[model samples]
Target chain A: MKELKILAVIAALVGITYYGIEPYAHSVMHPEVSAADFTFKDAKNVDTSLAGNVENGKVLVEANCIACHAIEKAGHPALMPNADAAASYGVVPPDLSHAGRIYDKNYLANFIFDPVSAMHLSHKYPVGGTKAFPMPSYNWMTPQEIMDVVSYLQSVAPKVTEDKEGHKATFEAACGRCHSMAYAKFDATTPKDSIKAYMGATPPDLSQYIKSRGEHYLHSFINDPQVLLKNTSMPRVGLNEKAQEEVIAYMEEIGDSKKAERESLGLWVMLYTFVFAILAYLWKRKIWSEVH
Target chain B: MAEFKQADSMYEWFDQRLGIDKFVKVMMTEYWIPKNINFLWAMGVLLTVMFTLLVVSGIFLLMYYKPDINMAFDSVNYTIMQEVAYGWLFRHIHAVGASVVFLIIYIHMFTGIYYGSYKRGREMIWISGMLLFMLFSAEGFSGYMLPWGQMSYWAAYVITEIFGGIPLIGGDLVVWIRGNFYVADATLTRFFMLHVLLIPLAILGAIVFHFYALRFPHVNNEAGEFFDFDEEAEKYLAGDKKNSKVVPFWPVFLSKDFFVLGFFLLFFFYLVFFHYGFAMDPINFDKADGLKTPSHIYPEWYFLWSYEVLRGWFFEIAGISGKSLGLMAFGFANIIFLLLPWLDRSPMVKPANQRPYFKYWFWLMIADLMVLTEFGKLPPTGPNAWVGFGASLVFLILFIALPFITKAEAKKVGGK
Candidate 1:
């Protein structure tokens, strides 16, 4: 019993002594630069340009991306067979022939920065699950090199449409990494299991996405999916406001031709629900009062 | 239907046949503990909670973690952080939980010292705890290797190099551990299994034995009476004054335990939500590059003190190599705690407060450990090296000096 008070007092002293000596000990012990301080957190930011020449872009793609991607469809085979690539990486590299016709340019640029973080494919296809992302990060590529590659992809890809009002080019560049449409090479001959293998969950065919989600919702969501659903697997695409609008325009044009008609039909359904609710409330009150 | 309390409730139906309620009562409700035990006893419950968090969160992480070196980085960064549903939260909880567990263990040791928990017949508990500490260090190291990042690769390289300091078999032993000429696919696979399976199971087994050992002795309290239950009965028969004073373990100790657990979890959640990256080195984000080494490499914060002590032996010694002396100093600094039960020659089983100079020495050790930790974090050059050397020397000296000093102090107590 006598020892208890002393133990308590010493324990408190231990706390006080450690805290009291800490500030002084750390400052003196590490008067010089510490290795912990030699980190990239304090690194200076360098500005990089993502604009480059298409002719140069073609050369860069052949130099860099062409080993895996066949730009002209027949000239280049993958360094390994498609089956070998599939067995190794889960997803065989797709042909670059239609890449520019399917993906958004702004989104495509960011994807090149960090494919894992940008695409957020980690959770969708886990390690032992049917698939996981196999894209090697080209994080070493300069901003200009990325733009040059994008230009080359755009240069080689066939026009989805020459229509001035449509964003066919942007759609082909950004969304085409995962989704393909009715006229795409993948649609008819592609096996259902093959889609599930790489995508984990077969991405709902996006040809009618605007029809289901509506135009406004698509605009907001194209920038970041996690805003609506906190646990969304999709990464923030990090598109500028104009790029987001352009992506939405493409979806509106291709995905939902009858969007106006569907929205007009929604008003009548809401009106009917309102009138029925009022009628039901009055009838309930009348029946109860009469009983009383 | 409204009755919530009964001696025999819903589970009693099964309990009557199987004697399960008796087991519950024996383990929890009727479990006797010393009344004078302070908030320090709360650490045992807290440590259990920490272990549970580690295992639960670790299981969720394992679902997506690839053991292969080729895909390990992507498995953690791309799929887990970017795409996995709430994978970031689970990962943060795990990473943060590891450091927090070590923090609790450090304090838990201090708590034991104040109450003289290692004294009397409780030596087994202290020994088993030391074994847990050793295994936990390995567990932390192996888990850190799983990400296959820049620091992960280098840390593996640096730690394995220490084994090569052994005279003849060291070279072969390191090669065997790596299962390769270097840290590679095989090393990752080995570490993944050790982190996720082998070490955790070992720790669980040790914890079981530790508490089982404690059941016979009861908890050492602030009074440090070291009283045997049978001795208490003998005293009671002789009509001597006795104090059995204990509350049921269910309401009193359990409530206090959960209160500490709740407080700790609040801090844990706050860090996971707001400042999860506080302890994590950003260098680890980079994928493993064998060609490039970071300008400075050190182990995790928990290992800083020993690493610094190891670094202090770089200066020339008379016969032994610097690495050998450093290795010896490192081993002694870490393993000395294990020997304290035998080394502390004091006859009395009283707590630190009851002793004249024990508290002063303990406070000095804490300050020394803090200084060593600082030296470990910094490069061993300039003033840091000198300080490191001084701290390492003192750390070794304390172990030798303790038993003799404690014996003299007891003699001064005049045959109490």
Candidate 2:
């Protein structure tokens, strides 16, 4: 009779567990929003021709962005002094080196057209507390030109393109700025002591990252590393929803080729365990018969 | 009773050579346990399984995890989850396991409180478990910092800054804990080391001590009487006591243990797979920016009650700043478990369920904790602040009044 009572309690516990998770699973788990819509008065002309045209976008970037924003990566200092520009603007212009990995095209285009609004800037500080250093809105230049400049910025952004193919595209694009990924191609001949260091720790090799952590771990992680984990020095890479999915999809494609196969096997494991439980229960009841 | 007499030939050979037979006879097959213990006895075994799962999953996570600030979050988010094979399963197991461990611990503790398991000659056993709970809180706080999320940053700042509210050397102490002027790489490095290695070893030592402190032949039952174990053992060993009532630890309890463990596993895996986000704070999704301080900062659910107590002291008292007093109150609340043995002055050792007034007070304390925990998540203003302040006073009164309240009730019931 007592054993039956225990079993009844176990059944109730399972019901309680289901109840505990129902509300959370329903309301919080599968969040629904209208696809992060960001449209404007004139988006049609900008949206049509300049989606992925790298060539025409480069020319537009050279004409406008080259004055302050250096898009390309190079070994030496810029030929022109940028100190006067910083003093006048009150803040150094952020490098557009990995803008593609950092910012999605939608945000980049939106920011280009209206920096004050897209970046949540207040009217009190048109250029973030600098009255004279306002970012000139390219809204006057047909949205096509602004989009072309965005395309140009993304085209120049660092990407892992089969060169070693170990460090990821987004990883190389964002993290490669300060960290070295040479460890990806390290071998028997490589000198361990000669390895480059960044941020006081050996710039971690992220070659096997996707194959090792929990799924859905990266979305919030990349959105805001510090917010996801506190006191972390990792700045938000600023990927929009679509770009975030693309990066993660690329990572999953490369890192976990056998993911589908492995997850499919979980069913077999549960089935085997369920069968064993029935046998185990019968054996336990038989063994305890004498005691009662 | 001699189930091993006709064991396999290989086992007989090994037992003769290595004393395996004698060891098993002494410990496993021969060890006797009381048969009347309730369902709550399963919690200890449940806790052990949870700990083992945490360690195993933690090791897998630590393998690909980068402790560096710039690399840590990205490595966990992008590399591990996206690239690793079954990495998500392992990480979820560890993350969800941390939250579940506390739930199991609360059950284990309340069982002890309800059954009066912390009776005469078993003070050390209770103390060891309490000490382990303290260590777990530290481990949880440090591990939370590893993700470097928004809550991780602000919670760390808010909690650590409370130390700066100290009269003297508080500033120095804050820097000492952070290993810098603010939370940085150095803090993360130390937290990683402690979470992975040092603290786990200490917890393991505490578990060993807790088991050792469980005195022989007396499994403190709901009847609440401390039996004379030496006298009971002598009669049983001499074969003069026909009604031994004690059963071998192997088949009797081991089978039941496995049965209970199966249910726990089902419950645990369900959470790890489907509902892991329930324990996680949503605000933590944003990256930590030092310049931006979030409007409302809250700790994890387990720490909320204490955080509410800390926040309750909004008004200055006795010439000391409320913040400084709050720091003291928070620290004391955590350490207050140490006073449990002395605080309840009832001479009777009856199960708390039998003590009517004590039972009422016990539920009140639990309700008080529930309210404080809820208030901790809300903005500290309006009813949330004032009610939480009132609740904090009630929390103190519950502890202070326990001995007097329970003692008076015992006289009416004639329990002793």
Error of 2 at B73 (Å): 2.5
lDDT of 2 by residue, B20-96 (tens): 97887656666665655666777887888899999999999999999988888666655666567777777777878
Candidate 1 global lDDT: 0.68
Quote the chain B TM-score of every prediction.
Answer: 0.92, 0.90
Candidate 2: stretches off by over 4 Å? A1-280, B1-18, B165-167, B225-244, B279-289, B294-296
Grade the docking of candidate 1: incorrect
Model 1: interface root-mean-square deviation in Å: 22.1
Q: On residues A6-95, what C-alpha lDDT tens digit does candidate 2 reach at each position? A: 558545643444343334323433343223332322223345345656777777776776667655562223434444444434333555
* Tens digits of lDDT, candidate 1, B1-416: 34333447658766665679788777886676665666678888888988898999999999999999899976886576546776766777788888778878877887777667887788988888888888888999999998887889999999988888777898998999999988889999998989988999999999998888888767777677755655553443344423543534665566656655655565666655554443455557667779879766778778888888888887778888878999888778778899988887776677676788676777687778877877777677888789989998888887788988778877888644
What is candidate 1's CA lDDT for residue B22? Answer: 88
